[model samples]
Target chain A: MARVATGDAFTSTQRAEIDRAIRDAETVSRLEFSVYVGRSDGETRPFAQRLHAALAAPARSVLIVVDPPARIVEVVTGGEARRVLDDEEVKLAILAMQSAFAAGDLAGGVVRGVQQLAEHARKPQLRHTD
Target chain B: MAPFHALLILFLLPAGLFLVITLLVYLPSMRHSEGYQPGQVWRGEPEWFGGPRKGVEAIDETEPAAVGSGRDGGESGRGGASGHW
Candidate 1:
């Protein structure tokens, strides 16, 4: 079997759920979404930002970095991504995730964060635009 | 050969065997005996480090250029925030 992620971080079932949530979030926001669950080698924020920059399209991607042992959660938005997912919206997602992690619900926290970000970033359908 | 040499060798043989057995079996089990251990933090190396990846790619420290890494193929600015639980 392909061990895509660290086994202990999430079981196969849980990983599938989280992956689905990420895909759904991407669809809603029309942005790239990536999630990383591992220990942070350095400062969590900088490490997350580094990870964000390395993505294929940094400007339109949303990167979520979770350092479980450190109990840290960071939501990074690319340039274009930030326009739709504003700072406050990102903070709200972080807050939600933090609570979930505090309660030892890693998968739940990620799913909730992804949903919240996607919700905040979703473009409202214009009923009438001449 | 000294008279006490045989006795010393006999004592050392058992002692060495016991040490080898302890190292081979006992220590590792005790070190990781806990029910579950969460994954370690990112340290530039993981089991799948050099292997081909799909979807999300881990950060490469030396290479700043976004070659085939990102999904969107756009430049990213540092615009996100962080929080601790």
Candidate 2:
């Protein structure tokens, strides 16, 4: 397969893999998932929050921000998303990603982290509506 | 040994072996050159996947305080975690 080189943090194939992971996560959790791979303007936490706030529907969104140069990874869950994914759950995902990043697998870390988050936030199945 | 045999043993064999060894050692590193390494300066532009295409630009222009203010509602429902490698 030909690798498409883009002037971006990830190669085209890597981006597509992340996109698919996000899509699957969204499908499972019924929440929007966005990934930002780049340097933050200031503190990574606040920058991630702002990006989360900018989403079309902040209440149902999850934003993952990764700053490779700074070695920072932040996950921000909006109003509604926070309900299903608490701080503890997010922390678990963060740890998983941190280990992967430590080994220089940026795209792989993001994909795994997103998938883990979605699994944790998966909507409860309705047994009966009667 | 004949001239042809000596040439094959000393020149052709070593040249072939060197070429093979060089390729084996160099190709894998080239394939992995794009991966991010800790402490390496990042040169790529920022990218947002699954984010609002246009709204994100505007967020960067607004005062950081205003964005922070969004956290003030009584619910303060936003939650997440951060980490470093």
Candidate 3:
């Protein structure tokens, strides 16, 4: 599909892809994924956390907040999300995001980060060990 | 000290100071800087990379995103982490 202008973080196409990524992440991991990009209202962490808290399923949601001008990227996962997605794993996602953000690929950074989070949060296939 | 010795000290002091200042100013920043990666196409406008332009299709600005078909209800219990780069 052709790209359309969207007066937000990403273009219509970019938003569509990001939305798709979130869909895939949720499908695989059974967790909620949210990406918020914009100039932070204030301190990024608090703003991001607040955003996370206000989600439909905050307890199972993962919020990725990116403040480009401020150069702050926060990944706040909910209770269950953290249980599955873990700190070290999320940190890995954050590092991937940090690299992409540093390289000036906001959309790509978000996409990679979301994909990483989903992979980490994915439920492992059970193995029958006798 | 000899005139030559005094001249050497004078030159050395400034040169050494310059070197130290340069190190102090640039080293930490360079260390902190994320390593260069080539070719990342930013979406939307140049400024969009800076942050969300508007949060267009976001669910709740307080929270966000598009999720799976069923309502997973990904609630918040003060879980997760945060950082910057």
Question: Among the candidates, what TM-score does chain A have in each?
Answer: 0.91, 0.92, 0.89
Q: By DockQ thresholds, what CAPRI class is model 1?
A: incorrect
TM-score for chain B of each model, two decimals: 0.34, 0.40, 0.36
Error of 1 at A107 (Å): 0.7
| RMSD vs true structure, all candidates | 14.0, 8.9, 16.1
lDDT comparing candidate 1 with the true structure? 0.70
Model 2 per-residue lDDT at B14: 100
Instruction: Write the number of the candidate with greater TM-score, choosing between 1 and 3.
Output: 1
Instruction: For each candidate, report what fraction of the true interface contacts it reproduces.
Output: 0.38, 0.66, 0.31
What is the C-alpha lDDT profile of model 2 across B1-85, one tens digit per residue? Answer: 9999999999999999999999998876456546555555677778889988684595766555535743443355788888999
Q: Which segments of model 1 are wrong by more than 4 Å? A: A1-7, A128-130, B1-58, B61-77
Q: Per-residue lDDT for A21-128 in model 2, tens only?
A: 999999999999999988899888878888887778877899999988789999988878988998899999999999999987899999999999999999789898
Q: For candidate 2, what is the TM-score?
A: 0.76
Compare candidates 1 and 2 on lDDT and give the better one.
Answer: 2
Top-scoring candidate (DockQ): 2
Worst 10 residues of 2 chain A by lDDT: A1-10
Q: DockQ for each of the predicted structures, in order?
A: 0.16, 0.28, 0.12
Residue pairs in collision within model 2: none
Error of 2 at A10 (Å): 1.0
Judged by lDDT, which candidate is best? 2
